[model samples]
Target: MRRPLARSWTNWLLALGLSLSGHAFAAHAYAQFGDIRYPASFTHFSYANPAAPKGGEIVLVPPTRQSNFDKYNPFTLKGSAPPSMLGMMFDTLLVGNMDESTTAYGLLASDVSVAKDRMSVTFQIHPQARFQNGDPVLASDVRHSFERLTSKQAAPQYRTYFGEVKGATVLAERSIRFDFVRPNSELPLIVGSLPVFSAKWGLQGEGPKATHKPLDQMVVDIPIASGPYRLGPVQFGKDVTYVRDPQYWAKDLNVRKGQFNFDRITYKIYKDSTAQLEAFKAGEFDYMQSFIAREWARAFTGRAFERGELIKAELPHGNAGDFQGFLFNTRRDKFQDVRVRQAIALAMDFEWLNRQLFYNAYSRVRGYFVASDFEAKGRPGPDELALLLPLRAKLPAAVFEQDVPQPPQTALDPTSGHTLRDHLRQARDLLKDAGWTYRDGALRNAKGQSLSIEFLDSSGSMGRVVTPFAKNLEKLGIQVQYKVIDFALLQKRMDVFDFDIISNRTVGSEAPGTELLERYGSRSADVEGSGNVIGLKDPAVDALLDKVVSATSRPELVTSLRALDRVLRHGHYVVPHWYGAVHRVSWRAKAFARPADLPRFYQPEKLVTTVWWSPHASAAPAAQITQPAPKAP
Candidate 1:
């Protein structure tokens, strides 16, 4: 997760030419901690099969829980965009292979070099790289992309994500340099991951009559980019298809060789998982990854599954467990106190929910970085103390005095001496101490304001999951309302931090950096459309985030993250949920073939779109790839 820098792009552009020389050499690959896996001459990633045949179409549902997409521009804040567009239709300067944690190989850029002072990174664009219209990619286009993404017209999060980078400058027709505010190891990868698109995208009319729409207003304009696929067929809100470009520029590039095997990919939208599951059983799509344990266990059955026409498999991954939980917006005055937050969190009985609802398919999430080395364990060590001691005045006593906080447990395991009743009693006591007394059939604060909670979400599928938690909150005399709204409205409310509570899962990364700042930094807390969904504004947290991003080594990064984790866990800002170690996926048998070696970290959509291919597809097969859908207005 990257964050916006404090300074404006104009400031950085003016600060260019500060007398710094680029490094004497360049490399085909770069890594955060100086650990590069593949050599410069390597053919393709070990996880990809170069010989994989590619003419077939593979249909899949959106990996996320979105019901419909309303915009083609994903960078805007107003509406939900199709999840498939960014990855399929946009190209980045550098791309990271799934097998490696932090290493990046040049994609659009052929050579990359970092300044000796570490304040800048330069890239030489590939001359062969061309947009869908066959125009060559230029340094000016890279600069245009950076400026556009960091501008106010785009989502505010990008400004915060690229906040450290002063600005991008075109050194030559095919060369560009990005100047950072300070020396940081992660800055190179930060800028490298930038999604670059043609400057001509989203333009209407021609010559004097031409007009360029703001990113948010380009709702249906097809994006012109240098990606492997182009927007093919669309049914406005129901489904979208992507057709592989026959003249894709980097088809033979060393880093891209066996990937993006599908000639055509289609994504179907459904209102709910039940409908999606029925459609999958009816062969409406080729694959589905089930997040609901009950659906995977009880509902994924029929003659098609019995006869092995559909295969159910749990594919294990080494990626960190994504932090899924009920995030409390601290911006609200009702949740301002730490004790009140702590009291509310205790009402969630994860042990009961996992046993009764999830069918023991998950483990309780311990912290923000669960299942990763960054997750703080037991107590702070000497290194953590060295970092935490300086900010002790601004932090809570629990940061240093207590062990890492754990979710309240019940007597699901006999040895765990507590029960749900005991936990609720504890919650009641905490609420009382916080001046919230249960009277008038409600938990009222000293001013007689009833403590109310609205659990906001876009889908009703989580109604069952929240029911038990709501029941527990009701016991405390709290007014709990779980409202399910449309995705666009939900997004709009979330942007302004308008809800009391929302359940979200921040995707985990092997090498987490700038993204942490966006999620927890004080600078981002008040920024609308920012990733700081929790409304965290602690200066101590802000200090630690700087250290995490600027750390020079892997050990240093881990130590900083662990300390930060301990501080965040002590805040009690979230009601931690459960996570599964493997993906519960069911795909049509004989429809596709995958590589023998599984990448250590990947999502279901990535695996399906990137490395999997149809076994029977031919170069000139006579199959209609997709049904013509209604065009966008």
Candidate 2:
């Protein structure tokens, strides 16, 4: 018999111990030590280095085009990309990590409990939690928010998530209860991560009707939130400002007691990243979130670094999820063969991309689900396996062993051409098995149809990465073509499932939830507005995902998740890409303070609204730590 991956009982015991002990080191159980740094004055708040800075109009540059906050309601927007940063600004309930860990720590609620049957969940509302307008947060508001979010008139995305909530009823002034048709252990985690809008504000109109106005008009003109910052002026093509909420709730919560220090958080919009970098160098912006590895590698050599205008801070890889390498348009007849998919995965030279483009700044991932605990290795020891077996029974064995490439003993250096050649040979073999034979100088099927693939890339950086894949495919007698389209057009094509293969990045969550359903469930495959863009559907995979959402204990959840991950990998649904294991962030050193315990990934939604304080401003003293009075019953 195979060794168990992890024992459910032992895993639970360990998790319980870690949660109760308040051990800082235990929080990083799965993380490996590299170049992660923590400032001496940093506290484990939502923001990093609370004492670093306090006042400045720090400008943040978003990775995409100017956000369409005015036209889109986050709850309704459905696409491959994560929710807009603006949507995150409007609400806060839960936060996610890159590795798929979703945490429920926020202003309104501290802890959430789901009963054994998963029928009902009780949220312990924070006593001090109040809306931006200084109105006490009531259970009625929570209920109202849910009701509106789930209503058909609201955005469809919000409605889909709340579909599981059979009914939401207010239990008391401070407690709201959710009744579900089936057991779902992930209920609390999911609901808590949803940003809660004031029912009064969101529902304002005749008889709960939703007015789909632009976000700037709804949020900025009349700002209302319980989060760290309130909406400010919207300067089209220039900057959007977020003013600190003076009467913000959670000001005294243990997790966020000393964060959100910036008086004004500004997002300076740029048409392209190169221009953004130029502005960062010119001190036009206070910080730059680096997506272009080549640009980041050359920053130090630029004029910006010589004058001490920029500081490169390496952040611990918080659990923002993976950037997936997808086998797009699975519905296309050309990609029906799994062998073909595997061949495509092998042909791409991620090693070269990492070295030449990324300057050896990233770590290649071989699996769909990245394991957090680096020490656990394969299956947990026998003792741990015993506890995991029951959960494993509900899932496929493939979860533990399928399609996982052997972990590299030495980090791959993309600069080495020898490694690239070996990878190429492996790819060719996989393709040959899939019925593509080299005839004359071109690869073709027995019927003489030439092997061809079109790579749809939306961004310049992704286009550059796909260019080399074309060469590798050509070597194997396969014709490959790449084209870059506008972001909007790409989105439209994705909606209709109209492409052969596309290269794009998806933000991973720290905790896996409905996203799994959206990506792999049969029900989601052709759902008109859902995110199962690749149209994957398998009963075994569905069963594993169901078990994951229903699992009550950590061990049970991990086992089910591991199984689901394995099946996806073995199926070659996605060709894995790279993660730096750290955030490549450059911020104005003197503009804002850093917090001690920073999230693995610094998402704009999570960081922009919280813990970003300006150094020159007079907000609150960093040491004024005090617990709020117990919430009233």
Candidate 3:
């Protein structure tokens, strides 16, 4: 799922939406697409078994790590930290349903409401919700959390995310409200997902005598939060552990019932995927989500697996498989031309790569949102045309005249069969049309600049993946060089948008919200650290994004996103990569048990952590008969 735009923002901006009936009222859960699934009086989530026993450890080595996290805080940009820091250390106002895309049920806040004008969303904090140190979670604490996240002291991405919120207000003792700059349905949900922490977290003491230090300066101080788990032990870069809170508040809440079952959840850190997977095979860890196709196929086939000590399950879902591709940094003068980008895209033979390198584990990424309802198929239909017609003069003639652009398949001669050679010939025409002619044995533009691509990446294996494409570019008299560097240096370069080409992936979400602005907005195109790493700036894209955000219904959202997907595909922003429709997971057997039913759309890690609990007291993966991942939908 490392393809250009892989969808995993499910947990980042967790599920939300509401019943518009009677303007607004307190509800157990909110869903964007339809009626709420669980009733207000529901005992536990349908996906969770309330009777499942807890009290065993679940060990894991993640596919990636920030490495050497000195700070316990994840809100700031100064340093990196371990995963689940937000949810484990601090509890959000609402817990998003793992099964639903964006449905949110109250966690800390017992009830919530929004003004009819949508200018403000109010939440009534549960009196029972208490922090780790036994302090009540107050309305002021909620305000403090929101103010800190949106302030200049925090990460810039947070400012962009909560930009619509004017400010947080303490309406009363337990009631808190967030005032928005604009009245939008999404604003309430966004604010509802905020992680609430006690004000005493960074402050020294209670009342006016408390001395507050800047949050970014915290090196290794433990966070004072009210979540089910608190920081247990830390070993710097090696690993971190969370001990389940025995006196944790809201343990029996309807939304939280049967969730967070483990007595201790420890996330181990490894240098690379190879080491991590090896650690899992050796039983150093209990669970892993494998990212490498080769490892999944060949590496997990030892005696442990044969003896039922290990299990590999590919869980499938209907979540959108967003694009992951090689991005051309358009900020560079050489890559400004669309034709040149198209030629580069044409050179990446995913069809051949799938058969050879990937063992047919992935499908070629055709458009921005493949494997979902949002992807563009066939010619522009009448509904899509209505949206495109207004911008006809500003768009490409091909947008109206031709079918959407798709990467060429295997091209072979009937008698003297050859595939990639035909692709290279086609690429030659594109570069030639763009005035990059093969003269003096080099492809040079009219300005006398030789065409060269500098592919920058942190992964050493990426160089091998792009090697075949580079050779095809070389056949067209174009220079292609792969640069593999340190992860830290790569992050710095990526922040400043200082690369010719990058084999990068963007995290996508089920519901595309204001985050789209950070990824593709014109303002973020120049901002360092913004998600718009490709430096994409287009009026048409900007317009489409607006349409995407303003969509009012599921049907409207699909229509708008599909139209946006088509336009972005037409822009040739990247060379489509490959994506796996199902989540690849391998875990230790007989340690855990889960509900027979599974949520249709879910992040595998979230599901396991929350719903599954250990039946074996000795500590192992505590889940039921493994449900193998279904074929891609």
Candidate 4:
């Protein structure tokens, strides 16, 4: 049976330490500690304590998507795409919460302080923090890192994140100060998450080459980081290894005081999830994060669960936001009508799909925006509104109002099957109101144009999830053409905004920051390689995003976020899909000891690839396993 949720603060704290301890022991021989200062005894199962012995290699087999480590150059990388690579090669000023949020704590930097006006922030770098080559990390390096990232030669994604920094100056040998043109409360969090690179090493290439490069041509051989691990050996298109840094600085800082227990980590690449899962079952890989629930339920039968060989836990994912959804491209005239969007949402039978396809292991989301507990829960209190009402007095009234009402609980029930029919009727009525008519069993507009929509979906499970929705639209006298494409082509089309409707997956961060601006802001619509694949361009969203980025207090930030969420919900830009409960990962019980504080959401900071280990694994003899076929529906 699973452990019960902690009922008290003490219990929660104890549980957190215990969980972290479990992970440290299973992965590496490490020591455990109750406090930060005192040294603790090392044990074979002591993986939670930072003082633990750090030697042993762990092999990780991710469900899908291989490591893009070859493209780890500081100036050229985009998105969080380089974190896994950088996590091994370099360290950032601050790191993400294990749960994967924008709220960063100090890593290379010991602490950060923001001015009351939020225009200026100061970072106190750890004196011992040094690059892999033993050069001390200085304020100059921080300034150089920011300057290169913001320069015109950098990728657009990297430039947008640091464009808010008005100036960066070295205040002291171990300190850097950043002044923002406008008050930006989220600046520290954003900068902290960005890996700091060696100024001397990064400035050598083309003096800063900009434009995009093919994934294959990007460089990954030499990496410079101040973190606990440095890049070991990486074979392109095969595997990347991370070896522990004996002279790592900030290994004893409060934030990183109890982490990075594994001595070495190896990430093996597999093109498909089925192949990856089969490799896990045959013990070629030590762990597999399960995404297909039906397969998991069947595999963890009598012996698997009874023997404690297979572990399943419901991780409270604070950063796991709204269900993955289908986004409509408003740029297309066919999807311009709200009725068409509603009709498409209504005709789909989520009840049948969830029960049959997902084994009822997911939750349906009705809102465009989702919030974690760390995020704004609902309407802000009076104090919060006071701070926000001044900056956003002229904002849309919809921002303050909960415009999109969630479907009734009964309507959300997949077993009832009546909600879809009811919504379908409403869709039909709305279409008629929008001057669309059903004639000869087909929907037509006033211009005598047949109502047809083309949806782009990636091949495999993603395509399967979208197929039912396409059929549902057909039943409503609407034509939906499904175009299945490979992941590469799908990514390219999304980057260029070339699709009508696209089904994609997005994982939200715990601390909702400006990264979201790229997804919904007007300015981001035209930014090349941005995540705003749907091309959303609303002045209201822009204003809300600005408020979210600049709010000084937690209350003010929450209020601003809720207001922004209300607007996005009313707009109905995307039809929400499903959310998994926990990260279902299957691993060899005999291999590595699990951490006490296993992450709820896997991000660059909390990846098992950086921390897990296998005491029995060795380089002398390679184990081989055959790939398995895709799981049957």
Q: Sum up the clashes in candidate 2.
A: 45
lDDT, candidate 4, at 323 = 43
Q: lDDT (CA) for every model shown?
A: 0.85, 0.59, 0.75, 0.61
In candidate 1, position 14 carries an lDDT of 33
Q: lDDT tens digits, residues 228-283, model 2? A: 66555555324556666555666545445555666666677665656667777778
Ten contiguous residues minimizing lDDT sum, candidate 4: 25-34
What tens-digit string does per-residue lDDT give for candidate 4 at 1-633? 312211342343354343433121111111111111212232211224554444556677544554333354545534223335655656777665453233455567765666545577778887878887779999888887787667655666766677677878899999888888786656766666667866656334464563433322335425455767765555644565666666667666655555676666667776565666666665676666656667677754555557777555445543556446788887788777665666566666666678878889877765655545333335545644554466455554544554344532324665755566676778788788888888877899888888887777553656666677677667678877778666556666777778887776777654476777777877778876777777788776787788878765555566677666656665667777777656666566776654566555564225555455445544332112111112112
Ten consecutive residues with minimal summed lDDT in candidate 1? 1-10
Best by TM-score: 1
What is the lDDT ranking, best to worst? 1, 3, 4, 2
What is the TM-score of each predicted model, taking all chains together? Answer: 0.94, 0.76, 0.89, 0.78
Model 3 is weakest, by summed lDDT over 10 consecutive residues, at: 624-633
Which portions of model 3 miss their true places by more than 4 Å? Answer: 1-22, 204-211, 411-418, 439-441, 618-633
Query: Which clashing pairs does model 1 show?
Result: 1-515, 2-161, 3-160, 3-161, 4-159, 4-160, 4-161, 4-163, 5-163, 5-164
Instruction: Give per-candidate clash totals.
Output: 10, 45, 17, 18
Q: Candidate 1: misplaced stretches above 4 Å? A: 1-25, 204-211, 413-416, 618-631
Q: Evaluate model 4: give its lDDT.
A: 0.61
